[model samples]
Target: MADPQDRRPAGAAEVLERLGRLSLRELSMESLLQTVADLATTVLPGDLEASVSLLVRGSPTTVASTGQLAVDLDERQYERGHGPCLHAARTGELTMIADARTDDRWPDYTPRAAERGALSSLSVPLDIDVDEQVSGALNIYA
Candidate 1:
């Protein structure tokens, strides 16, 4: 049974400490990453969602997500072949959409994302080893 008590840490440092102390021996990579995605929402101050996008064999995939909205949006971008997540993943640069409905960039994606209630978003590229042959980004939507 899951614990009823909500004991999430209150600050970024505490969260980082908790994450560092978490046991990974029994946790699958997906579970640990999902926890990171969930923790991102707690660390950021807003009503937002987060997801992890990974590029494997030149195909983008959502490896972890806080909610269906995050996963769905990632999938939408994946199917269309472009979006903040993919851009960040490929370029290892930060991608931010201040106003999805008005953003000139990603003309096809931003508007539809706004229609779905995503007013803004930030995509931060993750640092996976080049030797590993994988690239990814942490996408947050608000």
Candidate 2:
């Protein structure tokens, strides 16, 4: 009998192989960013903005994004140096803005998010490096 993971599908097998390889060595940062953005757009169940941001030398920077809203928000955070995701990256915690219009954080960025039709968002830190130094973040928005 074929292994379930091997029998899933051609693309699935390829992805699994890639992930397995990733686990053994340092992942190409660009490849990882692209993979997450592609998953956000095609695999995820909902219509929401998605992003991947990396912490380089103690600074957060957006590496990839799936939607305009998310890209803009990430840019805002990068430019202004503030946002829920930024805070989350710093503390290595999940962060959410249930309703950006009412959220007190990101005084400048929230309005821009609202103007762009983003109502809420969730941000989670991704484990990339040892010691969990908040290598990056995954964000979902609606």
Candidate 3:
């Protein structure tokens, strides 16, 4: 299988061209999310599902989501107060959920995420607050 980040659709070239030309700081919050959605659509293989979240006060909130399933899964993680994403965001560790159904770590969240078709996920911590611990999370859901 191709690397998920290398996947692209018919119009992906154009979208990537635009994405490459813009900086995140130059875009509005809404535009930033749209750009992320566009990138997720074009850069991910197969179904190309994705969601991005920001951590505030140790809680994760969806900043952008390409589909409902992704949003639901993120919310599930937030609701449970524990999940790979949350842990990764707080501790600045890479969290990988290869298969939510079989992952025993998130007992409360795994089943719900699996029900929403999120088989795997990756959480990358972002240093939103330069003066504090990681203030946000950037999650990639698959």
Candidate 4:
């Protein structure tokens, strides 16, 4: 049986169109994050799940997630205090784990991620002004 979330990869044009609509919506930060997560799962290839992790008052919080899997994965990293998403949020750098099972950097996280059926992950830091203390990471799991 096929996963219901599986679908054909979206074209660049379609992705752009969906993003453009985001600008027109009167969405709050939470709403915007949800929209972004939904769009990511739809536009990206592979059996992907998406989530947004935000650092508020120096604590990691999952502001939005496409599904429970995303929330669970984020919690795994938060509990261990290390993972691709946490690294990206702190350093403002893109962190890609091509194969979670083989990734030696986050020994504790890799195994848990693998158990969740996440073979790979990509975490991108959301750009924020230097004056703003807020930090965020956009996490994709496959």
* lDDT comparing candidate 3 with the true structure: 0.71
Against the hidden reference, what TM-scores do the models get? Answer: 0.89, 0.72, 0.76, 0.90
Error of 3 at 6 (Å): 15
Residue-level lDDT of model 2, residues 86-109, one tens digit each, is: 877777799988998899778898
Q: Candidate 4 regions off by >4 Å?
A: 1-7
Q: Is candidate 1 or candidate 4 better by TM-score?
A: 4
Which lDDT values do the candidates have, in the order given?
0.85, 0.71, 0.71, 0.84
User: What lDDT score is found at residue 63 in candidate 3?
Assistant: 81
| Candidate 3 RMSD to the real structure | 5.0
lDDT, residue 99, candidate 2: 94
Per-residue lDDT over 17-94 for candidate 4, one digit per residue giving the tens place of the 0 to 100 score: 988888635888898888777777777777778899997656899999877888999999999888898899988999
RMSD to the true structure for each prediction, in A, is 3.0, 7.2, 5.0, 2.8
Better of 2 and 3 by TM-score: 3
Candidate 1: list runs displaced more than 4 Å.
1-9
Evaluate model 1: give its lDDT: 0.85
How displaced is residue 92 in candidate 2, in Å? 0.4
